[model samples]
Each structure stands twice: as structure tokens, then as C-alpha cells.
Target: MSPAASKRQADLLKQEGNAFFQKERISAAIDAYTGAITLCPNVAVYWTNRALCYKKRNEWTKVEEDCRTAIQLENHSVKAHYMLGLALVNRQKLSEGIKALEKSLELGRGAHPASYMVEAIWQQLSKAKYIEWESLSRERATQLRKLKVACKEAICNYNSLGNPAADAPEEQLNELEEVFKKAAKTDTPTEVPDHLCCKITLDIFRDPVITPSGITYERAALFGHLHMVGKFDPVTREALEPHQLVPNLAIKEAVDSFLSEHGWAYKIR
Candidate 1:
């Protein structure tokens, strides 16, 4: 068959796959997509379609494999990255999954800023980040506890030996104690950056939205303020409406990156 004939056949097969997928015939959809992939091996969409079918069947490993191939064929394929992220998460590779999801969101936002798919990807990324933060927080707490115990033990041993010449120095022991003291000082609130915080709530932004006046606010707080007060910007006090609010993805991403590095900040509420 000519190259053009092969391309036409592949397109038809992909259409068949889409029809099967719409009817919830996942196995049939996978088969159709596989046929398209076989004919047009370079087509990223065929591989992504197959990956979607695998995802529906909870076949995460296959989804991962297909998505990886699609990404290799077209690195900017948002669907490929999104499916790969979910597959990796289901396969117990949360960190890699989160990265893939982040890339998908970045690409989706750039290519389709107002696309509904961008919001869906953002929601998944949010959930993934939360899970990662939760796990890391518990792990770090356990490690801190162990370190404090070790520090106490070292101090006690030095004291019992009456400061033997070979014992750890008093300076080292003091520093270790100081480290735990600071670590245990959970009462000291994490200092969130001014730009990442809402002016109205004075708290770190969870869901940031931008007003028409070019000011950002926490979504819930802004909504509450508008309901209780009036249709005006809290900071500017200019005429504002709910429809004028837009998601502040840049600030939200910055907050997410900061929280990822400083899991302690997640407790700031």
C-alpha cells in the first residue's frame, strides 16, 4: 500500500477507536487504536488513545508504556503526559507522576489557557501534591524524632563519661540539642511570602484568583468578602463582579513549588 493509503487507513482506525471508546467498549477501543498505531507508528494520537483505553481498564503498566511512546513521538502531547502521570501514580510512582502531571498542565495552559482540560489537569495535580506533602510530612516527623533521641543519647553518654578526651565535644552536643529545639518549635508559624498570600486573609493561597483590578486573593475569602460586603474589589474597592475573577495559575504554581520544598509550610493552613 502507498504511504497515503496507509495514513488514510490509520485515520479510519482511529475513528473506529473513538467510537468504541464512546460506547465504553474499552477492549475494542484498544484493539482499534492498536491497529492505527501499527499502520502509523509515528502518530502520537494513536498511542495516546490506546493508553486511554488501558487507563479505563486499570491497566496502568500498559498505559504507562503507551504514553511513554506517545511522548517520545510528540513531547508536547498534553494527553500523553496527563495519562502517563495518572498511570505512574497508580503504579506507585507518585513523584514522577506529579512531574508528568505538572508538565501536562504547563503545556495545556500554554496551548489552551481557557480549555476545560486545563482545569481537570490542575485538579489532579493538586490532589497529587497534597498526597505527596502528607506522606513527606509524616516521614520527616519520624526522622526528626529519631534524630532528637540520638542527640539526647549522645549528650547523656558524654556526661556519663565525665567528658572523656575521646568523647564528642561539648560544642557538637550543644549544636545537636539546638537543632532539635528549633525543629520542635512548631509554634513558630512558617513565614509565607507576601506575594503568595492573600491580602484579605493574610494567609497562604490555596486557590488564588485574580480580580479585574490586577489583585490576587484567595478564592474562598474573596467570594466570602464579595457576598458579605458588596460587588467591589477588597483592595481597590473598584467595581468588581464574580465573573471578573480569573484563576491565578502563576501564583498558585509558585505556592505549590514552595510547599513541596518546605512541607512544614503545609501546616500553615
Candidate 2:
């Protein structure tokens, strides 16, 4: 076929890939985009699209490779640099990633708000000394479910299953559920960034001393966590503060009573 015909074919493949991506048929989309690149190796769009698929797949190395290729082919590709920075940020290479993302912003390119916010949040994390995960609760679980859908659909990768873009296949979802079950079963303290840590901070940063008495032990402990190293918002402060569900006693006392009633650990904090 002529070069023009080949180019046309490549474009068609990219379209097909986009369609497959919408359907959550990630593997199919990758194949299509890969074919497009093979047919027209110099097309930057194909590489950028394929890089997105890699990101969804959680294959950072491949995402970086594809983005680099796209950038090399077309230095003006804002999408390529933005996504490259995104992948780098998530990989904990925040400094270089910030630079790339800043360039994308300076170029006034991108339709993704999450990308912008992530970069902004990372700027905060880079300044902090410690990060802690929020005590995951029902609300967070709901948010994770939403986030999982968005990331998967948006990124188009196998590992993007837990993302907020697309719903993973049932089997993968089940596997993920099991993993979360194991994690929730443990009391392990996990490190979280300022953004997420800020989310649950309300629960940790509240006015535990709701009564004339001193702050409840649990609320005090939770407050200590909030101010231990980093700062949190007042809303988060109030949320983390333990209160009295009992007529006069602390919420921790009630929790202890329930734990004793169930023969679990008496200490709620």
C-alpha cells in the first residue's frame, strides 16, 4: 500500500483503539494502537495513546518509554509530557515529574483536572516530613470504588482495574476485594500523602474535648496523629476527634464497652 494509505490505516487503528478503550476492552485497544504505530512509526498520537494504556495497566516503565518516544517524535505533544509526568509522580519520582507537568501547564494543554490537582498536591507532599494513611472508613471505600472506575476507564490498562475510570472484570474485582479484606484485617500503619491524609484528617483533628472534661483519650491520640508532623484542615480535625456517645463518658468508653461485649481488644485507640 502507498504511504498515504498506510497512514490512513494507522489512523483507523487509533480510532478503533479508542472505541475498544471505551468498551473497557483494554487488551484489544493496546493491540490496535500497537498496530497503528507499526503501520506508521512516526505518528506521535499512537505512542501517546499507547502510553496511556500502559499507565492504566500500571506499567510505568512502558508508559515512560512510549511517552519518551512520542516526545522524541513530536516535541510539542502536551499529552505526552503531561502523562509522562503523571507516571513519574506516581512512581515517586516527583521532582522531574513536576517539571514535566509544569511544562504541560505552561503550554496550556490538557483536559484532565486530576492531573493538575495531583501535581499541586505533590508540591505539598514534597515539603512535608511525614505522611500517614487515613483510617479507611465506609465513605472512603465508596470513594475508592468511584476512583477505581475513573482511573481504569481513563488510563486503559490491565492494572487500572482499581482505578476510577473503568470497572474491572468480575474476577479481577473479586481478587482486589480479597486483597482489601486482608489489608483491613490488619492494623498496619500505612504511609499516605498529604492529599489523602488530609481527607481523613477531620476524624483525627476534631475537638475531642466536647465536654468540660479533658479530651477523650482516643480523640487526643488521634489529634496527636494530625499534628505529629504535618498539618490538617479543621473539618478533618473534627472528624477524627473521638466524642462521647455515652450520656457523659467518652466515645472511647462506649467503644471499649462494645469491644468487651464482643470479646475483642478493649483498647479502641
Task: Identify the candidate with maximal TM-score.
Answer: 1
Candidate 1, 75-153: lDDT as tens digits: 9999999999999888879999999998998898678654567767877887787777667667777889898888778
Candidate 2 residue-wise lDDT at 247: 29
Residues 26-95 of candidate 2 have per-residue lDDT tens digits of: 8999999999999999999999998888888899888988998999998867778778877776677766
Screening candidate 1 with a backbone cut-off below 3 angstroms (N, C-alpha, C), the clashing residue pairs are none
| Candidate 2 deviant stretches above 4 angstroms | 109-269
Q: Which runs of model 1 end up more than 4 angstroms from their true locations?
A: 159-212, 217-257, 264-269
- Find the candidate with the highest lDDT and give its number: 1
Q: How many backbone clashes does candidate 2 have?
A: 27
- How close to the true structure is residue 44 of candidate 1, measured as C-alpha lDDT? 94
Give all candidates' CA lDDT scores. 0.84, 0.58
Displacement of residue 152 (Cα, Å) in model 2 is: 54
